[model samples]
Target: DQIFSSALTAALMVGLAALLCGAVLYPVVVHLSADNEQKAREVLDSHISMMEALGRAIAKRDSDTGAHNYRVAWIAAGIAEKMGIEGNTMQALIAGSFLHDVGKIGIPDAILLKPGKLDDTEMAIMRTHVDQGKDIVIGAGWLDGAQDVVAGHHEKWNGSGYPARLQGEAIALSARIFAVADVFDALCSKRPYKEPMSFEASMAILEKDTGSHFDPGVMAVFKPMARAIYDQLADCDEEATRKLLQDRVKHHFEQ
Candidate 1:
């Protein structure tokens, strides 16, 4: 009986030792996991920063001040939220807005930088940017989400637009949302070919193109917020606008 009791006590001591060790190691393992996660995020953030920088570079190449892309991103995100677009899909819209013109990087300077209107041949070459842009985004593992927008941003609602001529809902919703924001910013911002239109004029143009150029449903949601979005972003510079939109991407996409 004495020996059995001693053995039992020893077994209990061994079990307690194991339990104590596990208890001590649990928090350490958790901390290590957290550190690993943080490191992974840092790596991802670095990739995103590089990708965004590339977007800005592409914008500059296209003779833009680079603020246009950021503003478009801001507008697209807001419109998307209003339209109840959320999750990874919404991230695609925002990212695609930034990188939409990335394919312009491939276009020759003569055509892409021409201050005047593109002639028929030049227009054909320019339109190839959408497909090029899709290839660029789709090839990048991290940016694969942006494929829809990059490929279809120029597509018209009535199937009159380029590349695939995708119509209505057949076009990815992200691209549809982006089209509205893209034209809105384009109309409001000064370009080499045209002067910036006034808010009222811009709204008029947007309203006129509702079904032909943009998704009617998306436009319906955007019409009410257009002026407000412009007011909030009109005064911001490229860097300021980029930072604001970057924060949105980090919050919505990176999280």
Candidate 2:
């Protein structure tokens, strides 16, 4: 009888010790998890800020207000979400969209800001921006993932684009997805050289290009959302557009 009582006390003592340990460790574990999450968020924000700063620098060099980068990124994110792209690929798409034209920083102002059509020589120099952009991103460890769109955004579905001329699925999917967003934003946004094309007219042009200049599947996904995206972002000021894009970036990167 005494042995059984001692065994019961020992078992109760062990259980009580376990409960004490858990009671002490639970808050510590929660604190560590929360700390790690905050650290991760800070890292993501820093990366995003770096991307935005680089994008703005390129935009300023090209005589833009930086709305162009924000708009394209936002538009690309929308299309990617609709197409069921998420996680890292989605993050890369957003980064690439913002920094796609970053190579333009290397172009001569004479060619980059040309008021008229680029002569063949000037055009060739302009085309080199893709390579310049590729080099820039490849050298930056944080931005290496953006290389796909940076290098291939100019590539066409047909084998006609410059720098690489990657055709069809040979073009990275992120690049293909961004191609539509870039051109659509350019068409719908006014430039010093031309008026903004109407949404209907822009869609008409995109439809005309179809499989030749864009991925058919990507185009199809973008078609339905084009109107709403255009309406929301086409005329937004820099502040409004940046805020909208920030929300998207946060959603993608934080998740």
Candidate 3:
């Protein structure tokens, strides 16, 4: 009886220990998972914040539309996805659409802010921004995905564009998408040199240039979203727009 009692007690102790471990382990595991999720959320927020700061910086660089960059990036990514470009292509769309005109950082204030039309000499200087943009993207460590867009975005579907003057398939796919995004933003955005053209007029312009200025497949995608995208652009405040242009231009030349 004594021997049997001792054996039963040992068995009871072992079972109780196992139950304690199971109970304690679960809360620890749950706590760790919750901490990990919080950390991930913070990291995601940081990346978005950085991108917004970059958008503001780029606005300072060219004195053009800064938020317009963000809006176009969103629109172009949506259109690119619909057209069957996936994965890294979508990422490139985001990066390229945001930094497509980064080379304008190198342009002189004269051409960038001229109140009138660019003469031939000014236009030539203006075009140099394409090559300058290519160099900037290549040199910058953070903008690895943006170089192709900066360099090739100006290239035409019909081989009439600057820099490499690449035509059709020779141009990077992101650039092709950017051609539509950039033109749409430019036509719709109020600029120092030109008033914002009405949407009806802009559509007429885009339609006329179709195969010559933009990729056919990309245009097919942009057509349906054009109205919606303009609405997004319209949400921007003009005072903020003017301040961004004025401040950014002043800062760039000061540097």
Candidate 4:
């Protein structure tokens, strides 16, 4: 009887110890998990900040406000959202739109900042920005989605574009959407080369080039929202535009 009682006691003690250890470890596990999540968020935030800084640097280098990218991103996201584009696709569109000009960073100021039309040689160099931008984006693991826009934004619908000359559907969808947003913003924003066009006139230009310069399908979705998006960003300063774009990016990527 004594031997049996000792064995029973030993088993009960072992079981109790295990239960107590688990109870103690549960909170620790939860705390560690929370810490890891926070660290991940911090890392992601850092990466995004770096990208934004690089994009804005390009904008400043070209003597344009970073607002150009902000407006383009907003327009792209709006069109994408209306088309029910969600998940990684939408995130890529937003990110790629902002970094689309990253390749221009490689161009010399003499060629990039020229006020007049680029000669054939200069134009050739300028065209290489697309490939350069693609290479830059491809090097960064976090910027994988930006490759399409960075590589193909200058491509035309009729196969008359630069770098690759990819025609029609051969071009990436993100780049197609970006082309529309880019031209829209460029026309609406005043530049040293020309005055800003009215929304109607801008639409006319976009409509005229449908199926030639832009993807007809993407243009169809963007037509309705074009005026509204332009109006919203028309008066926004650079800081406000950046804040708006950052919020939209965070909503899509962080969630």
lDDT of each: 0.87, 0.90, 0.74, 0.88
RMSD of each: 3.0, 2.0, 7.8, 3.4
lDDT (Cα, tens digit) per residue for candidate 4, span 5-119: 9999999999999999999999999999999999999988987887888887898788674778888888888888888988889888887898898989999999999989899
Lowest lDDT sum, 10 consecutive residues, model 3, at 246-255
Task: Output the better candidate (1/2) by TM-score.
Answer: 2
Q: Which candidate's lDDT is highest? A: 2
Clashing pairs in 4: none
TM-score of each: 0.89, 0.93, 0.72, 0.89
Q: Relative to the unseen true structure, what is the C-alpha lDDT of residue 1 in candidate 4, on a scale of 0 to 100?
A: 100
- Least accurate 10 contiguous residues by lDDT in model 1: 56-65
Model 4 Cα RMSD, Å? 3.4
What's the CA RMSD of model 3 in angstroms? 7.8
Instruction: Encode model 3's per-residue lDDT on 1-255: one tens digit a residue.
Output: 999999999999999999999899989989999998888767645644554566666689666657667656666676776787765556556766776777777788888878788999999999997887677667444456677787887899999998788999899888888888778877877776679888889889988998998888889888998897687558667455434433432332222
Top candidate, metric TM-score = 2
| Segments of candidate 1 deviating more than 4 angstroms | 1-22
* Candidates ranked by TM-score: 2, 1, 4, 3
In candidate 1, which residue pairs get closer than 3 Å at backbone N, Cα or C atoms, i.e. clash?
Answer: none
Q: Tens-digit lDDT track for model 1 on 113-148?
A: 887889999999998888888888886876899999
The clash number for model 4 is: 0
Residue-pair clashes per candidate? 0, 0, 0, 0
